[model samples]
Target: MPRIHFIAIGGNVMHQLAITLARKGYQITGSDDEIFEPALSNLQSAGLLPKELGWYPLKITSNLDAVVVGMHAREDNPELVQAKTLNIPIYSFPEFIFNESRNKLRVVIGGSHGKTTTTAMVMHVLQQQSFQFDYLVGAQLNGFEHSVQLTDVPVIVCEGDEYPASALDKRPKFHFLFPNIAVITGIAWDHINVFPTFEIYKAQFEIFISKIEPKGTLIYNAADDVLKALVKKQPRNDIQYIPYALPQHDVKEGITFITIERITVPLKIFGNHNLYNLHAAYWVCKTLGIDARSFLTNIQSFTGASKRLEVLLQTNDVTVFRDFAHAPSKVKATIEAVKQQYPLRHLTAVFELHTYSSLSTTFFKEYKGVFNMADSCAVFYAEHALAIKKMPPINEVLLKQCIAQPGLSVFHTKADLQNWILQQPKEYTNILLMSSGNFDGLDINELKNNFIHL
Candidate 1:
């Protein structure tokens, strides 16, 4: 096994990759400026946590077999500089993953949203059918012990991210994976810091479609008008385009069910967006030799990918959920999903301005009426987060005006949010928390425990 050094290894998937490699008997070591919870604990549990915080150029010795750079590291990072100077084989995780699976049949799930869940859905059904495959998902999916798995396998499923691969690479991660089968959940403008304009953000997907392996199959969401137009705009006669729409599904008393082949199968997940994602998975599985009925039968057990509409607590009276939805489109979709599922309940939605895009004053306007579906909505953006990101303080009035929700409440402090959540009516209210980041260290399980007896 090679000695791999991870530069800025505290990232969600980076840490998991380090763990997987170390378990495979590779000598793995990692360093980061600061490591956060989950990643911090996970690395320590794997005995791979760096002994010190921050970059150490000295650690990038000439003997190191390779230097794996994470997106968190800057181009001029001291460790990266050292690795470059030493001529160490440098690669981003995506680049490395693609290289490792070059000989495998790759299924890359790309889009602005729903990549994680859709990839999880495909992986779940494949595993259930006893298929041997590798995968790189963005989140910690239930039943899967790790997020990145690389080995001698014929098939590799990847959650293709549009974020820049690495500071050094400067290309979207998905661009690195030339897939035999590609899925686009939908195109939504996001990562405002990188792709500043929606057109520029979307152009990456166009490139992605062009990069698909010759004669590759493209499964996309036909419901997204922008994406639909993009697919139609391109005349790639070499590839097969398979468009998927939301399947026939109905919600019955907070439970969602989908129909396939004249048989009804109940689902643990909700949302029209999720139903569309399921269809994306359904098509991919179908292309990979899994029958439609088999895909549906096994998908019944896939509760969901973690933090993407994950149910935190549920009781007779109160139901609490948290999701990794920070973008305007995602927030709108999540709010609608929860509200539609529990239409009878008084929905109290809480959102955190966690991403740089969500915190931007310009991007705030994109959130117009996003939370309008919720009975009560509150937005939380930590002043500390703004200061750390070096972003200008958000104008509270402008934010409220942008959201356009008359009943919306804005909170800068977590204590205020905690208090607000505690005060929401217990018996008839369904609390939904949406953010890619933890609400500035708010404990969801603890919050759920408070309403356990209700």
Candidate 2:
């Protein structure tokens, strides 16, 4: 059996990868300063959880075949330093995944948004048809036991993130995949801390396009003006371009039904963005030889990737949804979707400025009219987040003014935000809690229960 140790194994993908390798007969050991739920519980259940917290350089021995370094691990990490001294090979998560799937056909989905949902959609269709393929989706799907899987399958589908591979490797994670079939769902300005400027952020996708293998296929969204401009600006001769737009669909009493070949297919998912995602997924599956009718039949059951418009509670009068939407484009789309789905209901949208981009004053300017559809809009940010990100302290008064929405409320604490939500009249309304973080550790279930019991 191969021996591999993880420097930081408690991440969403990291934990799943650890368990994957363990199931593959590798001796997996890992350490982290702190491991939170889902990851903690998952690692514990897999019997791969570290007995002790914090780094232990002694764990990095010459006997280990490799050290898998996560983004959470710094260059100064003792285990990493010791591994270097021991001449043990170090592999970032993407690097390791690439090595594992080197012989397989890699279908990588890359974009600023919609990658996870699109990837999940493709996975759902493939699984429904019983197509045996390996995958590394960002979220947990209904039937999948793990988020990452390594098998002898000929194809590997991955939700390619644009974030840096690791501290040691500053290259974007998607850059390492060198995909055979690549999909760019739509590029929006994001990861300000990593890419800094919009031009620089957009350039990464261009590089990603260039990195696709010769004779590879590129499926992209033509609806995005920015992405379309980029694709046209940087023409690729070596690869094929296949563009997709939102499919023809109709909404009847809150259900979105797709029209294909004069047959109507009602979807569990709604919204223009999701419709775009469905189109992208359809193209990818079509490339893999799955017919249109089969794709439509299988996709109806895919509720969505976890946290992408996940409904925690739904009644005829009230519905509560949570989404991992911190970026301005995602926030705007999600709000519009809920309002469109439930047009008559009053929509209350609460968002968290959690990511570095969302917190930066320069980037936050793009969010000006994102919440216009919501009847009530509230923004919340943890004060300590500014210090942690080494950003200049924000002026709430100035920030509120920057938002420029009438009757907009800003929250500095979780308790105050909770109280505000509880105070709202809970009749004939839709509540959307949007954040990449936990809204400063606010218990959403408790909030949902309160609304239900009231």
Candidate 3:
């Protein structure tokens, strides 16, 4: 078993990867300055928890087989510096993943949104078909035991993130994977902190297409004009370009039924965006040799990736959903899904401006009209979140004006937000709590329970 040390292992994917490698009997050691739950509890349980928080150069030694780097680790991170000085091989998590799967077939799912859902869909259908494969998905899925798997499996499915890989390796994570087959769900400008302009952001996807292995396939969303235009502009003679659209579907009695060939199968998941993701997954599975019938049969049982249109509570009177829809496109798509699913119900869309991109006034205007579908819109921002990101304070009046939604409410305090939510009309309503953050430690379960018996 090769010994690996992780720098900044407190990251969501990093800790999960460490735990996964440990389970496979590899010697895993990791360190981070600050660790948060789920990662903390998970590392503790695995007996790989750092004895002390923060970087220690001593952890990286000449004897170590390799040092795996996480996104948050800076170029000058002491452990990283130590590893370099000791002549130890260093790999970013994605780079390491590519190294492990070099001999295997790799499928990379890349896009501004729905990376997790699309990747999870591919994994779910492939597993149900009893095909041997490995995977790296962004979110927790119902059946998947871990976010990453590294083995001798002949195939691997990866969520190709556009975020910069690490401080030293500034390329997008997906660039390292060098996929044999790739999926680009769509393009929506995001991560304003990194790629400041939309064109700059779109350029990343262009580069991703260029990275596909020769004669490999590129499955993309033909419905996305920007993505389609970009994909079409890139003239790759060796690559097979397959475009997918939302498969014909019907929503009856609040249930979405997808039409596959002559068969119409009911789906646990909803939304046009989700349908788009499923279509991409379908093409991937088809490329891997799974028939349409088997793919549709397995996809019917996919509840969805965690926090994407996830239901917190459901009563005849009220339905509460918590989603990780912090971006403008995602927020709009999620709201559309809920309102369309429960058109008759009064929809209250509650959003938390949690990410640096969302909180920064630089891109705040992008969220305008995203909440238009909701009957009532509520926006929350925690002061601490702003402080942590070191962004200037956002003016609530300006935010409201920017969103331009009728009767939209903005709350800075969790208490005020909770009160606003609880005071909402309970009967025949759908409340969607959308954010990338957990409302700054807001008790979601308790909030959901409050509405259950009301």
Among these predictions, the greatest lDDT belongs to: 2
Candidate lDDT scores, in order, read 0.90, 0.92, 0.91
What is candidate 2's lDDT per residue for 1-454, written digit by digit as tens? 8899999999889999999989888899999998999999999999999999999999988899999999899989999999999999999999999999999999999998899999999999999999989999888888999999998899999999999999889899999998999999998899988998899999999999999999999999999999999999989898999998878999998899997656579999999999999999999999999988999999999899999999989876678999999888999999999999889899999999999988988876788889999999899999888888998877788777777778789998999999998877689999999999888899888888888788
lDDT of 1 by residue, 1-454 (tens): 7999999899988898888888778899889999998899999999998898988999999999998999899978999999999999999999888877989999999998889999999999999999999999988887888899887779999999999888777799999999999999999899989998999998999999999999899998988999999998886999999988878888787789899767689998889889989989989999999997899899999988888887788888888888899988889999999888878899999999989999999998899989888988899989899989999998999999888898889999888899898988888778899998888999766787789854
Candidate 3 lDDT tens digits, 37-154: 9899989999989999999998888879999998889878888888999999999899988988899999999999998999999999988999999889888888877788887779
By TM-score, the better pick of 2 and 3 is 3
List pairs with backbone clashes in candidate 3: none
lDDT at 200 for candidate 1?
A: 95
TM-score on alpha carbons, each prediction = 0.94, 0.96, 0.97
Clashing pairs in 2: none
Query: What overall lDDT, based on C-alpha atoms, would model 1 receive against the true structure?
Result: 0.90
* Model 3 regions more than 4 Å off: none
Q: After the best TM-score superposition of candidate 3, give how far the Cα of residue 42 lies from its true spot, in angstroms.
A: 2.6
Give the number of colliding residue pairs in candidate 3.
0
